[model samples]
Structure formats: structure tokens, C-alpha cells
Target: MYIGRFAPSPTGPLHFGSLLAALASFLDARHHQGKWLLRIEDIDPPRSVPAAIHRIPETLSAFGLEWDGEISHQSNHHLRYETALHQLQENQCCYYCTCSRKMVAQRHAGVGYDRFCRTQQHTGGAVRFISSNAELIWHDAIQGKRTHAPASIEDFLLRRRDALWAYHLAVVVDDAAAGITHVVRGYDLIDETAKQILLQQALHYQTPSYAHIPIVTTTNGQKLSKQNLAKPLDLSCVSEQIAAALAFLGHPLPESLLRAAPQAQLRWATEHWSMERIPKRAAMAWPGV
Candidate 1:
């Protein structure tokens, strides 16, 4: 059985870019007759907005992207992350790093981590996974063959110095727990795949198929995101929004279906969804952005 997921952080309300990822994941799962799960990545409470958590699902619902089963939140899975961390520690696959971001940058001239604490017996700091120096490679559903050089990959954080679970660790643990078989997300996340694959290998979890769709960007080459203050998805124009998002994914609905209800548009899209139509690129400028 195919299982796909759309895990988004509740840092802000869903925007046009958010819809792109959600719609892609939803359509791919539906087209394959698989389950689509929603997971709120709220592990970092300081950055999460309480209201956004409630509004994300509401927005997805408004766009007719209903998920299977109850939604899961990262905040509800601390013990699982802790267990995974402990397993890595037991296997001596990770070490505590006392070096701060500034310290690493200053030492390595802005390169990746130098693994200075891997052998220094550091304590009471962030946990860093011992990344392998071998080349990491994988076949992406959309991006085709991808490879990360040994030098490009480095020891990544599993836990933050503030005692917060890192995104990579939490995401890998949650996806494995949910039995996710496929991951449809933005192209910007493609680089993180290697690190996540390493985590899966160390934890003995199955790696899921990945399809990174082109992200929506502005004319000036800025990805549409809350950080860039991308406008919140306009709920009043639900039909148009769905149509636009589907078009961005390379499955533009017919003129008659363009003005259809949100659910109607989604039904048409699902029935005719074609992954091959999606542009094979890292980013696409939004129309009239």
C-alpha cells in the first residue's frame, strides 16, 4: 500500500506555496489509490503560531485536500524522538557537539561542520549525527538521479542546544512511525534527502520514495514563503486558487472546470492527475507574481 504525507510547520497560515506542496502530495496519493496523511511539524514551539496550527487544516479543507485518518503533530512525539536519539547514542553513531554555529563558521571559513567535538568528549550541547563520508545517491521521482559528495555531507544536528528536537530527526521518526511510503514536497527540500536517508539507515527504517515538485517563486527569484511575507492564501477565491495550483503542477483544468466548485475542481484534478506534466525544475516563477 502506498502512503504519502504533507508535513508542514505551523509557523504561519498556508499560502500559495503551501498549497502547491499540499496539492501535489494529495493528488499523488489519491492517484495511486493510497493514503494521504497530514502531520503538523510543531516540534519547535517558539517558532510555531498557535492560530496557524488550527488554520492549516482549515485551509486544506477549504481547498478540498482532505487527508486520511487523524492528523499527527510533532509536538506529540517527543518520546519517540528521544528513543531514536538514545538508540543512536547507544550505537555510538552520534556525539554531543559543544561548538556553536558561529564557532564552526569562524573555524571552517563558513564551510560545513568540522566535527570538532566528535572526539573531544563534549557534553551538554547539541547532538550531532556521525555522517558517513561515502557518496550518497538516490533516484528522485521528478528530479531524476541525485548525488551528494562525501565532502558536501557533514555531521548534522539531531537535537538543538536549546533541548529541542531537530527537524530532520523529528521528521524521519514521524514518517517511519506513520508508515509513509512516498513523500511529495517542494524542490527546496531535495538537499535534505541525503541527510534523512542517512538517519533512516542508522535507525533501520525504510526510506520512502520522494518527488520534489518545483516550488513557486516570485519574479525576483524569491521562493513564496511566510519568511518572505508571501500573502496568506486568499480563502475568498477558493476555486481560482485550486485551479492556479493545479496549473502550476502541470495539470491545468479545462475552461469549464476552472469556474467549478473547489471540490469539483479537485475531483477533476485527481481523475486526471499526471506527474509527468509537472515541470522538472527546482523553481518556477508564479504567474504575475
Candidate 2:
């Protein structure tokens, strides 16, 4: 059976952006007659707020979306990540770099890492993995073939100065470990796909299908992110929120649910989910309903 996930960081309430992602993954998994899972990506404890951490699951339940099996948290899987890191190290694919942020930026004007530490390993610095020969020539099941210049990226930190596991490392490891078959997420993470695919290849894990949905941008074309202080989702209008999300996917609601409640709308969504109806566009401003 196919498996997909909607993993969110606990940094804020379940806003429009989060709702869209959750609905997309849930509906897509149902469309494929597959199992959908929820993962709490709370590895970065510094950014994880209490409300952000607890309300996501509650919000999903309120929106009438349910997942299969136990929910996974990144914080609880550090041992597995450590094992992966150790495996990469054993293969000599990753190296340690003690260069400070200021030093690295001074060398390359804030481009990707300059590979200074690729050869000269350092203690008490970040750990970075070297890239493989093949990249930029892969295709995502949803987005199709994509290309990128290797020089566009540097050996970014897999482990940071404070010894926190980087997002890049934990995500790939988690997805593979969880047996995810498809990844339906926001377009903001599109670029990360290459890095993810690269890691998948390095670790010899199967690359899942990737579908980057349009982000709920602002009128000024800015993405609705935690930093911009996007408004929290109005739980009071659950039906409207689900309808808006369906509209974003380019699958207009059938007349049957026009007067139905939020739970009804979500039920219809799961029953009639259609990947072909999803908009192929890369980005669009939120309808702001």
C-alpha cells in the first residue's frame, strides 16, 4: 500500500498554509487508496512553541481529517538519525568543518558553502556531506524532470555548530525510515527536493514521488510564513477552510457539498479526491476568503 505524510513544524497555529498542506496530503492519499500519516517535525526545540505543538493535531481533527497509525515525532527518532549519520561518516562521504558563519560568508559572498572544509576537516565545527556525481537530472513523479547546477549548492551543515541535527538531514532520514511513497508539500520546499533526492541516492533509499503545491501567498506575493505573522486559521469556519483548500487544488467542490458542514466537505473530499484536478501552477496568492 502507498503511504504519504504531512509533517509540520510546531512553530505556530494551524494557519491557512498548514491546512492546505494537510488537506492535500490527506486527500491525495485517499485518492490513491493509500494510507496517510502525520508527523510532528519538532526537532528544532527552539522554534517549537506550545500552541504550535499541540494545536496542529487538534486542528486536523477539527477539520475532519484523520491519519493511519501512530504519529511520529522527530525528537523521538534521534537514535535513528545518529545511526544514519554514523553510516555516512563510515563511508567517508561526510566531513567536519569548523568554519564560522562569518568566515564562510566572507569567502563566498553568501553563496553556498565554498568547500573549504571539504578537504580540511575540523573539530568542533559543522558536519557536511559531499555530493554525489549525479544530480540535476532527476524527475519527480508530480513535477517531472528538473535540472540544477551543482555549484549552486555548497556542502551545507548536516549538524550545526550547536550540535543540532539540520533539517536537511533529519527530513530525508525520516521520510525514508517511515516508508513514505509520495510527498505532497508546498512549492517552498521544491528546491529542497534536489538536496533530498541527493541524500536519498547517497543513503541508497528509494526516492518518493514529489508534488509541490502552490503556496498561499499574500497580496504582495509574499509567502504566508511564521515570520510574516500570518493570521491563524479560523476554526470557526471549518467548512469554508476546506472549500478554500479544495479550490486551491483546482478541484471545485461539487454542488452536493455546497451546504454541507466542514466534516461533510472533508468526507466528500476524501471520497472523490482526484490528482488530475490539482492545479499544475507553481504559485498563487491566497484567495483571502
Candidate 3:
């Protein structure tokens, strides 16, 4: 059976954008009769709020999402991350980087990561992973074949000067450990799929099918994010919010049954989910859906 995950960082509550993602992931997993799992992406400890972590599961359950198996937390898996880092280091797939954004900007010109420190044998504080021109070529199940120049991102950081395990590394190891066979997430992260896929291939892991759902955005067209202070999805209107989230993912429900039992509503959704209904575009502005 296929396995999928809805891994959300515990830095914030289940915001509308987050709810959209969870609902999409849940539906995608159920549609395939796959196992659905939840992961608390708490690797960025400094940004992880205490209250938010406690609230995520409650909010998800309020929306009728019950995950399979014990929930996974990235914070608890440092050794696994270290192992991956060592593998990358041993293969000469990564190096130390001392270049700051200002230094990179002045020197790199238009290219993002100029690999100033790729050849340097410097150690401590900063760390980076090599990105071949081959890293630019990756595919998505929904978006089909995709390619991009890695000029803006060459030999990027897997560990910052602060010495934290980067998202790229943590996510790669987490999915492998959890046996995630499918990944359904927002289009904002669709591009990052290539990076994750690169890491999976390097670490000798099976690549999963990916479905990039459109991301919810503000009236100004910016992606709804914590930086914008978009309020969390109101669990008070649990059913309505879930239905709205489903509809945004192109799984509209009949109004007569919008308030029906959560499991029943989910059942109807599973039976009717259509990838074609999922908008092929990126940033989506659902005015009142």
C-alpha cells in the first residue's frame, strides 16, 4: 500500500494555508487507499512555538484526520540526520561554506550560490552540499517533466553557520524512515521536490509520486504564510473549513451533506477526487470557495 504524509512545521497553528495542505494530503492518501501519517517538523527548534505543537493534532482531528501509526517528529532523529550528512561528506558531495548572503550577493552577481567555499577545506560554523548541473533535472507526477538552472543555488547549505540540520536533509531522512511512498503538498514546495529527490537518489532511497496542489494566497497575491500573520484555520467551524479546504483542492461537496459526519464526508471526497480537478497552476486565490 502507498504511504503519504502531511508534515507541518510546529512553528505555528493550523492556519488556513496549513489546513489546505492537510486536507489535500488526507484526501490524496485516502483516494489511493494508502496509509496516511503525520509528521511534526520540529527541527527548527528556535522557531518552534510551544503552544503550536500541542495544537496541531487537535486541529487535525477536529477536521477528521486520524493518522496511521505513531506520529513522527524530526527533532527526535538527529542521529539519522548525522548519518546522512556523513554519507554526503564521505562521497565529497558536500563542503563547508563561510560565505554570508552579503558576500554571496557581491560576488555571485546574478547567480545565487557561487560555490566560493566549495573548494575551501574550512571547517566549523557553516556547511554546504554540492549540487551538480544534473540536480536541475527532476520530475513531478502532476507537473510532469521539469528542469531549472541551479546557478542561483549551487552547492547550497545543508547546515547553516548556526549548525542546524537543514530542511533539505531532515525532510529527506524523515520520508525515508517513515516509508512515505507518495507526497502531496502545496505548489510552493513543488520546486523543492527536486532537491529532496536529489537527496533521496544520493542516499539510495526510492522516489515517491508527487502531487503539487495549488497554494492558498492573500488578496495581495502573496502566499499565505506566518510571515504575513495569516490567522490559523478556525477549528470552531471545523466542518465548513474542511469542506472549503476540500473544494479548494477541487473536491467540492454537496451543500446538503457539507455538515454531515466527518467520516462520511471524507468517504464521499475519496470516491470523487480528481487530479485533473486539481488546478495545474501555482499560487491560487480562492476568493470565497
Candidate 4:
């Protein structure tokens, strides 16, 4: 069974940009007759908005992107993150680093961490995964073959100095626990794949296949995001929004289906979903945004 997920951070209401990722993952899963799960990545409480948790699912429902089974919240899985962190520590695959961002920038001139703490025996700071020497290689479903040498990969964080579980660790653990066989998300996260793969190797977990769709960006070349104050999706025009998302993904619906219901548009999308049709570019400015 192919299990795919759209794990959105509950930082704000769902916007047109996020719909691209959510719709792509939903269509791809439905195309393969797989299960599509929704996970709320609210591990960082300071950044999470309580109202958005309820609003996100409501928006998805309004757009006819219903998920499978009960929704999973990252906040509910602290023990699992702790267990994975412990396993990595026990295997000597990770070490604590006390270097602050300012200190690292001053020392390494803004390059990735110099692994200064890797040998300094630091304690009580963020946990950093040891970069593997072998090349990180993977065939992305949409972006094609990707290869990164060990030197290009950094000793990324597994746990933050604030004690929150890092996304690299939490996402890898969650995907494995849920038996997710495929990960379809935005292209902006493409760079994070190597780090996650490293964690999977260290923990002996299966790495799901990856597909990074082009990200929707503003006219100024900024990715559409809450931090950028992108406007939320207009619930009054669900069908129109779905069509816009489909067209952006390189699968424009027929004229007759333009005014169809949300489910109808998605049904056509699921039947015709093609990873190859998506634009190969990393980011495309959202038209008329």
C-alpha cells in the first residue's frame, strides 16, 4: 500500500500556495489508490496557532481533499521523537553542540557548521547528526536524479537548542511509523532531503520515495507563505481555487469542468495525475497574485 501525507504546519490558515502541495499529494495518492494522511506539524508551539489547527482541516474539507483515518498531530508524539533521538545517541551517531548561530557564522564565515563541537565534547545544546561520508543519492519522482557528496551535506540538527524536535528527525520518524511509502511535497524542501535520508540510515528506517513539486512564489520571487503575509484561500470559491492549482501543476482542466464542484475537479485530477507533467523549475510565480 502506498501511504502519502500532507503534513502542514498550523502557523496560519491554508492559502493558495499550500493548496498546491495538498492537492498534488492528494491527487497522486488517489491516482495510485493509496491512502492520503494529514498530519498537523505543530511541534513548535510558539509558531503554531490554535485556530489554524481546526481551520486547516476545515479548509481541506471545503476543497474536497478529505484525508484517510484520523489526523495525526506532531505534538502528540513527543515520546516517539525522544525514542528516536535516544537510539541515535546510543549508537553514537549524533553529538550535542553548544555553538550559537553568531559564533558559527563568525568562525565558518556562514558556511555550514564546522563540526567544531563534534570533537570538543560539548553538552546541553542542540543535537547534531553526524554526516555520513558516502554520497547521498536518490531518484526524485519529479525532479529526477539527485546526488550530493558528503562534503556538501552538513551535520544538521536533530534537536533544537529550545528542546523542540527538529523537523528532519520528527518527519523521518513519523513517516516511518505511519508506513508512508511516498512523500510528495514542495520543492523548497528538496534541500532537506539529504539530511532526512541520513537520519533514516542511522536509525535503520526505510526512506520513502520523494517527489518535490514546484513551489508557488510571489511576483517578487518570494515563496508564498504565512511569514510573507500571503492571503488565505477564499472559501467562497473552492472550485475555482482547485482549478487554479491544477492548472499551475500543468494539468489544466477542460473548460466544462471549470465550474464543476470541488469533488468533480479532484476526480478528474486523480484520474489524470502525472508527475512528469509538473514544471521542472524549482519555483514559479503565482500568476495574478
Local distance difference test scores for all models: 0.92, 0.83, 0.82, 0.93
Candidate 3 regions exceeding 4 Å error are 150-153
Q: List the residue pairs that clash in candidate 2.
A: none
Q: Write the per-residue lDDT of candidate 2 for residues 40-75, one digit (tens) a residue.
A: 999999999877778888888888888899989999
Candidate 1 accuracy as TM-score: 0.98
Cα deviation of 192, candidate 2, in Å: 0.4
Residue range 69-170, candidate 1, lDDT tens digits: 999999999999999999999999999988878888888875689988989998679999999989889999998999998757889999999999998999
Between candidates 2 and 3, the one scoring higher on lDDT is 2
The C-alpha stretches of model 1 lying farther than 4 A from their native spots are: none
Best by lDDT: 4
Candidate order, lDDT descending: 4, 1, 2, 3
Model 1 steric clash pairs: none
Number of clashing residue pairs in every model?
0, 0, 1, 0
The worst-scoring run of ten residues by lDDT in candidate 1 lies at 103-112
User: Which pairs, if any, clash in model 4?
Assistant: none
Task: Give residue 182's error in model 3 in angstroms.
Answer: 0.5
- Residues 1-289, candidate 4: write the lDDT tens digits: 9999999999999888899999999999999999999999999999999999999999999999999999999999999999999999999999999989999998877568888898978767899999987888898999999999767899999999999988889999999999999999999999899888888989999989999999998788888899988899999988888989999999999999998999999999999999989999899998755
